[model samples]
Target: MNLSKTELNDAELSRYSRQILLSEIDYAGQLTLAQSHAVIFGLGGLGSPASLYLAAAGIGKLTLVDFDTVDDSNLQRQIVHREANIGQAKVASAKSNLTQLNRLIEINCIEQKLSPEALEPLIAEADVVLDCSDNFATRFALNRACRAAQKTLISGAAIRWEGQLSTYDFRNPDSPCYQCLYPQDSGQELTCSQNGVLSPVVGMIGSMQAIEAIKALLGLPTLTGKLMLIDAYSMMIRTLNLKKDPECAHCSSALTERDPL
Candidate 1:
């Protein structure tokens, strides 16, 4: 679709010219992308690339939540923050970079932990939520919140050259929530701290998460109800179909209620 000169200024048009050229995301889709808001959890490896791409894509607003501060170790994967920002809160550093990437978008930096109390309000306001956190606690927290809010959740995780991406939409009756595939009580333990991660692997998966979020917001088909696994070591990509669990407390209850539980 053609965009009026006023609708897309020279700078705006130039910035997204390549993306706007795509028929699926021309001026109209770019407009929708520019008007959408996304909430991203974490500010580490996965979050770093996801937030940067979304901001660069001209997402109208972004809410970034991260309780950590920039560190020398993060420089390897968290490309959004610089060495100069080592001591600064990750959210602040990320916001600063995002603002520079796209001045037209609004960004909210929450330099606080993602607690249950704060999850609902933030998730409610976002058209889509990106779960880029590394830990299970935060991941589960985000999943629960998104399920309750019936918001589409795009989750990505990367460690040791292996990455996984999944979309959870509790609003869809047959869709599986994150909790359905990975039970909170399963007691599976894995972390970047415990296992090394390739920096580029995080970037690859995180950027895909941003793509999924944008697709979800634009009502385009996505990886929902499927888990995408990637092994950077072998450059192999696999898709696993996910099914809603009848015994999953979070999704099962929502299923029974026929609404966000």
Candidate 2:
């Protein structure tokens, strides 16, 4: 994605004034966000809020990926789709809602499952990538892609009354990746639909994902190399520091290969 003009017009200044007012963000940070492209995979509970906030916050371009159709069951927590969109594809429904929120931003929709080839180009184009995808396969796939590209990836997952968030800035060689945290693929995956999720648990994590994405675009401090764990039932949040694995399959070898000769 091309970096759009940093200049904010009269209407843009008015729309994003509150964010621009923050000393940390100010006008320059907001402009950086306006020129950044965020690629979000999955338009479910987590992706819904993430996409909405990113769009409303004035991110210049957003690429939404999801192959599922909206279902009545999804309305419990997926806020991007409506009753009328039950049969509609998730990316389509998300694009409609996000466009309604911010018409000035560019929104692209992908309605198919991505192969590694497909994901690579998206990762290459994105300033930041959000892995809101459910299964570990997709998560691992995305982690590998981001690591190969040395891009920034913000990932979130929620199941039952628990949720977790993490950011892996692959540009920083010291930053641990998603695979560093979950090295093995568990055959069986836990999902909100199969177990149960408190609706707001996903909302909280998703909203935080958007914040991390914006911070990435603006060079702000983010959750890179730390895992945030939330348990709604206990009302507790904990962050665990992560370290790069020297023997890890995904990144360690690559890091060694890039070592100074």
Candidate 3:
């Protein structure tokens, strides 16, 4: 991150005026946002809102990764795409929308599935990452990358009228990663297509993910050690505390490695 770019210019101050008005994210917070970089691993339901808000809020740089193309089915919740974009790469579509939202920032689009070798450096450079991917493989890879990079991750999922959100700040030794909450062997993966998801349910969770990402960038309190569940059908929200798995292979090993004998 360039320290000099942390200072918001006149147009930036005016552009982000509403956010700057908040005492929590005044001039300094906005500047922090301007200097930060966020990488989003998925560009579907959850990634849609997350990328939109992050771009609109003036995150200095955004790296969008998605191997899929825009399908007509995505219009129901993927707000970042348009009907004309059907068949286009998701990252390209999202980049177009996000660039329109904020041209001052840089947007990098990767239109392929990233191997571990490709993902780690990107994670290492990001201040925060949003795991909006829909599969366990991708999620586990993202968790491992973030853990190794010591970056914060905001994870969100929505399916069948239920949405869940959690954050893992790898900078914190006690923070439980995605693997800790959901082990690698945790049965089959549930997807929006197989189970069905309400459009707004994803919008809600993605928006919250964006909020948590911004807060993490600005040094504010986020759901780092807690999981939030939203039962949209019942119109209820619940939060549960998360604890590190002392014997887990990922974060626990890092903790052990850092501690003295």
Candidate 4:
């Protein structure tokens, strides 16, 4: 990835004028977002709106990873895929839709499953990684890879009228990793297919992930070290502070490696 930033043309400035007008995202912040690369895993409900919003928000580049084909049932919440795209690969559908939204942005599609070796390089190159995947396996893998790469990770999940959001900034020595919250071999893998999820639940969480990713790219305040829990049934939201696990196998050693007594 090139380290240089992209200069916005008049068209781009006009296109993103409303977003640029925000104090949080002035011209400089918009430029920072345009120069950043975001890697997103899974194109289901979460990734759908996350990618779409980020693309519309002017993220310079996006690498979408998903090995699933669009299904008719997914149309309920996976808004990025259309009824005509039932059999199309998720990354392919997402890339097409995202490109249509913002031709100025570069979109990469990965249609195959990625091993940890394949995942780390992509995570390392990304300014921020969005773990929009539903399964625990993929979430743990992404957390581990992001920790190794020292990249910021915005993770989101939703199921059964509940949603979760958090940021793990590995660049900080005391930053807690996902493994710190969910230990290895710990997640029960309760899926949306089994429990059922409200459509907007994932949308809300995923949109928040996009915001956190943009904040991460622009060096702004993010949800790092805090977990936001949403109970959509009652419309309640709560945030909990997260602490680094000194015994965590994934990040504790990295901390010790950097500061050995």
lDDT of each: 0.85, 0.89, 0.90, 0.89
lDDT of 2 by residue, 80-170 (tens): 9999898999999999988888998999999999888888878889999999999988998888888888899999999999999999998
Residue-level lDDT of model 3, residues 1-261, one tens digit each, is 646684788889899999999999999888889888899989999999999999999999999999999999999999999999999999999998888889989999989888888887788788999999999999988888788778899999989999999999988878898988998898998988889999999999999999999999988999999999999999999999998887677766555443111
Point out the higher-scoring one by lDDT: 1 or 3: 3
Candidate 1 segments whose C-alpha is farther than 4 A from its true place: 1-6, 253-261
Model 3, stretches more than 4 Å misplaced? Answer: 253-261
Clashing pairs in 1: none
Clashes in model 3: which pairs?
A: none
| C-alpha TM-scores of all predictions | 0.92, 0.95, 0.95, 0.95
Model 1, span 1-261: residue lDDT tens: 112222656777899999999888999788888778898889899999999999999887898998899989999999999988999999999998888878977898888785687777788888899998877888888887887778899999888989999999766867888878789888877888888899999999999999998889778899988999999999999999998888987766545453332
Model 1 worst lDDT run, 10 consecutive residues:
1-10
Top-scoring candidate (lDDT): 3
- Give per-residue lDDT, candidate 2, residue 193: 67
Candidates 1 and 3 compared by TM-score, better number: 3
| Candidate 2 least-lDDT 10 residues | 252-261
lDDT of 4 at 152: 93
